[model samples]
Target: MQFDEVVYRIRIAAGGGLLKKKTKSEERVILKGISGMVLPGEMLAMLGPSGSGKTTLLTALGGRLGGHLAGSITYNGKPFSNAMKRNTGFVTQDDVLYPHLTVTETLVYTALLRLPRTLSKGEKAEHAEAVIAQLGLSRCRNSIIGGPFLRGVSGGERKRVSIGQEMLINPSLLFLDEPTSGLDSTTAQKIVSTLWELANGGRTVVMTIHQPSSRLFYMFHKVLLLSEGNPLYFGKGAAVLDYFSSVGFAPSVAMNPADFLLDLANGVATAESNEDQAAIKQSLVNAYKTQLSAAVKSELDVDSSLHTPTNDRKLKRWSNTWLDQFSVLFRRGIKERKHESFSTIKIVQVLVVAILTGLLWWQSPVDHLQDQVGLFFFYSGFWGFYPLFQAIFTFPQERMMLSKERASGMYRLSSYFMALTLGDLPMELVLPTVFYAITYWMAGLKHTAGAFFSGLFVLLYSVLCSQGLGLAIGAAVMDQKSATTLGSVIMLTFLLASGYYVQHVPAFIAWIKYISISQYTFKLLLSSQYESDQIYRCGTNQTCFVRDFPSIKTVGIGGRGSIVAVLAMAVMLVLYRLIAYVALMRVGVTRN
Candidate 1:
């Protein structure tokens, strides 16, 4: 892999007012003319103090950085291509693993989705086991990869698991960002040793290191030292001391060469005066540039457009077919999310809400038409809010995992999404059906089996629609707190426009009732419970026609047939999910 004159910059809004239509923007340079190369069977480590552009250059070399970038980057004397993307593996700074899954389970799913289709189930399992043992994760294979609140694997163990995920595919080029960020010295040395072993296997390994012990530093075959985006040194790790010593910046006392290099590199980055920082950084950059022999400079320069037709022919889309992808993703989604969907707390919450609702409208009289109508609307409101909040959290929580797996070309977004919405159906529908079984009868809405089943269908349909809307919001926003806030505003608007709170909404704003899932749901539930021919008692013991009731006349504007209500809700259900799919497509994968 090689990168020449790689430069990257990002534009950000400098300042803005609450009502202003525009804001001042400025560009910040991240990487400036960074160039380097790593060959197969070599281990290269990027070393620098914080804010030294180490991570930025690492990302740029891996073909993952996205910004205003210039110059060229090539792998194996060829421009970056789809085939190289599939053959590469990238581990992010943070280990984004499912906390609920055990180490074994995590690797197993990755193998199943990513390994070649020619591999059978047993072969995939064997591959997963191999990665576990290679990474020394056998002892914790069955332990959960826990998170902030959950206790599971240790820090070193978790980092190994993250590396194991990339290793499972047997990638020819592997890139890791600070794999030992929080590990102890012993653990950090072990992680570096593992990378050394991988490099010796003929795979090109490159990584960014925050700081490393001397032992860990010696494990690298080559090192790239940077300070404020300026290269300070680029050569063998063993030779770094001599290079810096010859430049008159060697450590005064005997100390670790890695520490001495950081002290020298960080001097410019943390200098008090801006002029001094720039002067020192520029001199070091020029010194490093001048140090390169003319012969080596000529050898390093190459055409960025060089084509490797031999590797280009190996560009394959995915490892498995659509059906296989769906099955694997479906099972994985279910296994990972079942705890959140059907935990004891969630079940108890649903049961408690159902019981309270049943008590609120217990055995309402049939002639009490106003009370029965209130019950139907309340039921509609409950299902709408409950399912919306539940499904709204799906995509936000999985954004990191999705980005990671998709970048690796493990599975198509469509397969993963189809499996996601479909797999959760059975689990999502169960609690709502239970809520209705109790609340429907206790509220005295209807007596016949046909009435009960038809009402159940409408309830489930409303749930699906609300859930899809939630998914759309989550996917588009990609932030939990923001999505929840937006969802509340939208759900409240739908509830208020359901034709229950105000029988006659203003004509201009009343159009909301058409798109509101709650509106049609309330109307459908009203029809399910009562008929037009029914009669209710009036003030003086005289009877009034149910057709003349206020809610009936106002909410029944779309005609009395359940077909229109059902069909409208169905259209909304499909439309909302289509919106979600498009939003997800925009989030796709990161590439060159």
Candidate 2:
């Protein structure tokens, strides 16, 4: 609730070259004994020139310092705790959003995760709509939050949506870093004005702004001007002029206050006298000390020692545990099925591949069991790489949105993990069904009812295993380029380890087969199709066909390799989900 005498100190190694070792020293103090408060119904603006540590100070106050914090930060006279940090909402400079999701869907999805579970879906939707209207985003509520590839909301609107997302949780304190950094002048002013209005409505708003326009400067009730990590001014907006005047240097009437302060801070202008300079500096120091002390007192009065009333009385009735959270996420996944891109290119790819496979092994009778086994392996391996490649290209966009929502405490990492697992089902089912139908029939594999079901089961298993592997790889690498490179490498490795070219793998590399989803899927499919006693007779000499197929039969549970395939897929799903969870937690939802 308040920060008293907060200081953020940093030390770095000095310059070093190949011939000399680096020297360690306290190179600089990024935030030198800085102090500020964000009381209810107040808006505090942190202004400073570049490299003045404005963002660093804001992060210190917001409890997002990670390993960079120094000194004490107290809330209501008690040291800041994790619970206190959770009560605040922070919006970073980047507009992290899902390009495919419309503004309304984005907000509603966030609400489902962050809002108390007791609220009905109708209540949640109503709450989200109200926030949308409040932020003046109603005109584009249904529009997509676009990137270079997709088109929808403008930069200003997207910034407002990010703010709306934070408000959905009704946080008592809101922190924003350069909220309008990249927007045009008109849009920037409008955004700051909206923030001013929100502060007036009983929310504590603290934001770090760089080079705000003249009009925007007047919206701040209080300002913290920093220079080289030291506080130069911290007090009322109008008082800044008087403080400057007291030092015998008057600012031009037309000069912007922020620009004037920054010029003085950078030592570009000289004070009339040495005493004038000292007097002005002393005045700022005293003002900061007094204001910081006052903030501490205020925070002490409403300390957590005294029982505070609950703000969300309505939230008491909604009680969704982890299971309910999973279910809600699962439903959202189903709804997102339409977002899957099944373009003409994808359909054409399937058709082209089908024709090629069919023509290569044209109407091969069941007697050619070796050929059938080869066809099964080829189809399974090809389908295996499909999901992996698709995920590498598409998952990054979803992850961008996921990170934003996760930062706002919309849902637990596990809930999102479950949703993604469930959401991919429809596409997985459709692609494999199409690929297998065309390939299996075209290759002229035995089409007995049992054989048809076995082929379909194998295809589904390949799809699931591929998706799981893709999800794992996506989670592990956050960047698109890195993920794509890693995905290609893993797919290639799997292809090699799947026994396509090398029938006998080295002893040390033998374990790779267990780890490779393609290996299991192809192996099971090959065994099921090539078994000597199966209805689909390969050659008149069944012995030769059976001997040619790998001896690693699907021996686990029942004679059905399909069952083993299912078991392997189940294991892959859990492994991938676990990898996703750990990666999400370590890297977090924030892109930077």
Candidate 3:
């Protein structure tokens, strides 16, 4: 694999928070005309200080860069294509595996979603088992891959699982970002050794590593040292020390060569002032150009004629059919969400809120019109806020996972999205049902079964609509905190215009009442409760309930409006999901 003159830049957001403007965005260069190459049967380790363009270059080469990039990347002397991308795998620094899945299950799902359609279920299982053995994860194959709250796999084991996930596709070229960043020295060396073994099997592996142990450093076939987006050194790892020593920047003692290289790249011992550091860095660059460029060029200039085609077939960009993608994703989604959605704590929280609400408005009747209206308002508000906050976390929590899978060309955005939305529907419906069931009879709003079920249907629809709105917010913002803040603002605005709080909205903004889901819900509840036109003794004389409250009629309150509310919510649900799909496609891949 080879990349030449790669350039990447991003426009940073101008101001802080959600209220900021984008008018004054600034451009920050990530990669500046960087170029490099790696051959089969070799492992290249890229070394750089923080923000030295190492990961940026890796992202560009892996076709995952989410900024303005200009470069020519080629594999097998041809321009990089979708087929090449499918043949490449990239492992991010953070392992984004599902906590609920066991080691074997995770790899199995990855194989199902990524392996070719020609392979049968048995074939996929066989492949997954093979990978588990190859990665030395057979010992933990049945152990659950855990997160901060769930303890299961060790960190080194988890990292290996992440690599194994990519290996299931049998990729020819692999890229990793700081695979050993937080591991112990022994574990880090072991990981590199494993990578070295993989590379020895004729797979090209390129990775960005920080301050590696000397033993780990020698395992790499090539070393590309970068500083401030410039190549300070690029040559054989074993010869790096000799090359640097020849340039009069030799280590003072028998220290780890990786540490010495980092000191020079980070300017730790190179100079006492900024200008002096710049001079030292420049001198190193000049030395590399004069002394080492030829040897590097000769090594990288692999003869195209020498390359031989093997029996291994190239893989397609996506392995699963569209329907198959959705099915696999839906199954995975259901498995991952069952615990969160049906957790004892969440169920208990919903029940407590429902029972407390029911007790507050127990046995309410028509004469107590104020309390009935308040109850309806409370019901609408709770469902609105509950589903919105719950769905707000859906995208942010999965951002890294989605990014990794999407970059790997695993599945379509629409397929993953439809599966997620469909997978959550059962829970979304069931939770609201529990809330409605506990409160419906105790509150005594209506006795007729038709009205009760209709109200429940409308309530469920409203909650889903709210969930859709939350999903759109989460996907568009890409930050949980910002999504939450924005969702709160939106929920509050809807409540204020709900016709319960502001009974008489200003004429200039009267349109808000028409759009506020809460208003529609309140109208539907009122219509259901007063469908019989029952008489109430509010002032010692009988008076019709609808007559006392004429605003319900003007606001289009009835069974017809209830039907309209459900339909409106359905449309909003689809609309919001469509927006979310578009947002997901751009979340980590779009330039700001």
The RMSD of every model to the true structure, in order and in angstroms, is: 2.8, 5.1, 3.2
Candidate lDDT scores, in order, read: 0.85, 0.71, 0.83
Error of 1 at 564 (Å): 1.7
Model 1, 387: alpha-carbon shift in Å? 1.1
At residue 169, candidate 1 shows an lDDT of: 86
Candidate rank order under lDDT: 1, 3, 2
User: What is the Cα-based TM-score of model 2?
Assistant: 0.82
**Which stretch of 10 consecutive residues in model 2 shows the poorest summed lDDT?**
549-558
In the range 1-592, model 2's lDDT, one tens digit per residue, is 5555566666676878899997766556677776665567778888888998888877777666755566667654555443444467888888887667789998887777667766887899899999999999999988888777678899999999989888887877789999989899999988999888888888889999988887888888888888777786777777777766775556755588888887666644443333555455565556555544465345445545443344343333223467767877787666654555466778788778877888888888766655766787687678878887776554566776676555444566666677777777776678668767777777777667777777688778777777777777777786778887887788778777777667777889877766777777776676555554444343465433353444333222125554665687788867776776677667656422
Q: Which model is ahead, 1 or 2, in terms of lDDT? A: 1
What TM-score would you give candidate 1 relative to the actual structure?
0.94
Q: Write the per-residue lDDT of candidate 1 for residues 446-549, one digit (tens) a residue.
A: 78998899789889999999999999999988889999999999999999998888987999999998899999999888777667777788667789877788
TM-score of each: 0.94, 0.82, 0.92
Highest TM-score scorer: 1
Q: Candidate 2 regions off by >4 Å?
A: 9-29, 76-87, 248-253, 270-320, 334-337, 341-347, 366-371, 392-400, 533-543, 549-570, 588-592
Highest-scoring model, lDDT: 1
Instruction: Give the candidate order by descending TM-score.
Output: 1, 3, 2
Residues 1-592 of candidate 3: C-alpha lDDT, one tens digit per residue: 8776678888897776678554677898877666678888999999989989898888778777655888777778776567776688889999999999999889999999988899998899899999999989999999999999999999999999999988988889999999997899888888899999999998999999988988998898999999888788887899988888888887877888889999888765543444477777788777777876666556657787845443225644468898999999999999989989999999999999999999999998877777877887788899999999999999999888887787777888878888999999998889889899889899987788987887897788788888999999999998999999999998888888877666667889888766677777777766666763655656667565653564454455555666776677667878888888788766663221
